[model samples]
Target: MALDQLDGELEDQEESSEELYEQHSFKIDGGQEPLRIDKFLVARIEYATRNKVQKAIDAGRVLVNGKTTQSNYKIKPADEIIVYSHYEKRGERIEPQPLPLQIEYEDADLLIINKPAGLVVHPGSGNPDGTLVNGVAWYLQQQNPEISEETLPRFGLVHRIDKNTSGLMVMAKTDQAVTSLAKQFFNHTVYRRYIALVWGDPAEDEGTIIAHIGRHKRFRKLYDAYPEGEYGKDAITHYTVLERFGYVALIECRLETGRTHQIRVHMQHIGHPLFNDDFYGGDRIVKGTVYTKYKQFIENCFAICPRHALHAKSLGFLHPTSGQQMRFDSELPADMDQLIEKWRRYVKAKGDLIVESK
Candidate 1:
């Protein structure tokens, strides 16, 4: 089907007889005067962007005093306002192709899954199918027939994982759970830990990376720790080495402040970028005899693993309803295990001594 037709179908599925909008009337108080209807609506609704608000007004989706209004129409204090915003259809049709998922724990309120490397967490842009969100939606539908297209989680996504990374992720099942989890994430109260394989060993065994991260002005797709920009946000990540395998090191990172590509960018900032990350541009010994020896192995691994070597290994947070501490873990996926084992064997065969860590 065409993209526009598919979008229309999804939108129709999102509509419901149940009204989602709430009517409100604000009286002019003190010296306050009338404000633009679109501006007023923007202030009252969360997640409604300025452009979306404007579009809604232009499309006759907003009414002032029970009458349709223009985008620039002003609103008085006693004017009744009504908005017909059918909850945005945010769900995508991601076919569940029997993709391997390592489920750790599950309950009515939430689910924890050990996501494998190369799987897109949510669908967007180039990837619209075979996402974790699609799998979850399929699973939920299987478990409960009441989980209709309209009630599906368009906003229940409380947290996210990078496309190439593998590890544990917590998903909210209810809107209440979503709100509670979102608050916990915003407050930096949720405990998130990741295990990554980087290119070089760190000088220090453990240390904190405090840096301001923002978009690279030159490279929009990649992030950088810029000194100035409205974009940068404070990010803190603490990392410790679990074991060093000569050229590579397995490290555990704990996030104090979560930002886009926090662990990846911070690791790159410290001069130790992740292995096999083509975007960041790091050095790997894939040349001459070494390249020939591992070419087939690398090809096989890449065919199975399409993402970076990061994983959300552990997550801890407060349960929404019970208010009890909850934590979940996901073990390393099979492909990564195979890669590590192959590298280890190759190193040992080349007479490179392996260090035993107790």
Candidate 2:
């Protein structure tokens, strides 16, 4: 699957994130006859037409034995199959699961949440349960037993951040709210500011990154910033260096267009990727010293903030019904705070030798 598929839609989010992909896995019976993959899938999968199956195969959503398969490929006995789709599938529903959530604000129209890193926003094939959606469903249902998971609008989510990127998020509680909030995000009127600890000091105090972003051609899990604009969707991110530590820097990113991995990819395009961001090549010492002590310090910093050092520090949007602009801000999670502090002390102590390795 393309990273764009996993990135989740950035706009017009009235469509639930779960609806972006439908997944089904099957193991062929031992006595099954050899048949074209598409026909085989169509016959076994409910509500799936031959046309739809063939289209999925053509789009590389159908996999046989863990590899993308063409429609003409004959499925032999004991073949393993998996299919993904942008449409709905039968019997798919979010099973409410109780989870610890930090809700900053809540009301009839919408709610603001400070999502922690490591928590997925919604459920997918890899994560069938234990998602924000599951917890929210349980929370909402606790108040109103009549609410149905299948019928809830967008599962009440207006927008989403990446799983490992901690930050604030807004969710609508009603269909009317869904339409209003989704339009705000789609129109690019929503305000969102993120804090990122990236490798290297940016030459400029502030700059804008304008590029086209899409999934990497080779690595589907990572995105690529296309400076030439030959592929992908247009994206823009404005960033300001909040502090400098010689080897690395603390930066604030204001997103103009929220493409998937927008800040991470754009920063890398400009030679600065977020610290400890394994996906975009920030896990290693991109900058700083190769000396044993410096390496140890960086390794300790990694242990302090293990995930990508990005946080959605603030979010703003107009109230769905009242037109009152609602904005929320969050403190950096403990890990990032400690990581930054360690860098602050390190830079102060060894200012002259900080960039020795770079």
Candidate 3:
């Protein structure tokens, strides 16, 4: 269907509200024919959801050439469009709460953090506060009152890690830094390494996994390797075994290409899935006579870390301004450390038993 038709459908569904509202104006330039309003909005606006765009269209909240049109409405070059939106005024401010943040390195360009496990990087649907972003904003403001809303570092975020994954992350302080760092990421020049504890030891000590990843057709939230070219992107991971328990192995993975959940998904593609990843959906426990000595420890560790056992261990990139190469590292969080220690003890105990039997 044509783009304007989609806009009409979107406009038909909007519900009117009595709350105070605001209006913003936009102009379309240098186009042959009218373009779909929704498509145009998505391109022009940052952080706008589909639902939000549709709602505005339906409410007759958007105008094309001074006339209300559907979300799919077409517009010509130089057409004037005004959008009525209900948004919190910009002058209102939110106070940042005091939260603990692990600062690894900091400079005028960016802040490097050893983000702890169990901490959300930013606020979202279920988490509105106590995020790494909030903490960073608070810390900056306290350090310099000059870092006001207008001057605040856009939090210059470059990348992300899962809430349960502990690791090194870089945040930009200046617009130039944000732009340069983003280019490095897009060019795949940023080097990232992660440490993961997975079930089972692979036959080979080191190997690479190359697969295309996309949303699972059956399950909406989880991602899986595409089976037959429906939806997926190229991903590459290289892993080397650091240590081995009776059943589990500690592996370090370097990313030649990074995709969402790349380490966990690629590890699962090999016979060894991460220790406790319910979303990938594995048997709750790995029970075998061969793993008897270490089974209890493994189960306990997995239970304690309900999320996947992956840590972003290191990050490397070129300084955006200085043109110097820099690298940062983060130690495994306490929980992961404890799990590794317990596994070591189990292996030692099992060895002692075997010697006694001999």
The model with the greatest lDDT is: 2
The pairs that clash in candidate 3 are: 3-72, 4-72, 4-73, 7-70, 7-71, 7-72, 8-70, 11-58, 34-75, 35-75
Q: Write the residue-wise lDDT of candidate 1 on 1-358 in tens digits.
A: 1101123322132211111222234444455477887777677766566776675565455667767688788776567776544333344444544455667888888888877667777666677777887777767767775664334334245567777778877877765565456557755888988887777767778899888776666776777764343457777889998876676677889998777777888888887887666667443433223566456655554554445667788899999899999988767777667666766776687787666433
* Per-residue lDDT of model 2, residues 239-344, tens digit only: 9988888889889999887677888999999999999999999999999669999899999999999899999999999998999988899999999999988987
TM-score of each: 0.68, 0.75, 0.69
Q: List candidate 1 segments past 4 Å from native.
A: 1-101, 148-152, 227-231, 283-306, 346-358
Candidate 2 lDDT score at position 137 = 85
The TM-score obtained by model 2 is: 0.75
What's the residue-level lDDT of 174 in candidate 3?
61
Worst 10 residues of 1 by lDDT: 14-23
Note the Cα lDDT for every prediction shown. Answer: 0.65, 0.78, 0.67
Error of 3 at 304 (Å): 5.2
Q: Name the runs in model 3 displaced over 4 angstroms.
A: 1-95, 146-154, 227-230, 287-295, 303-306, 352-358
How many backbone clashes can be found in candidate 2?
0
Q: Which has the higher TM-score value, candidate number 1 or candidate number 3?
A: 3
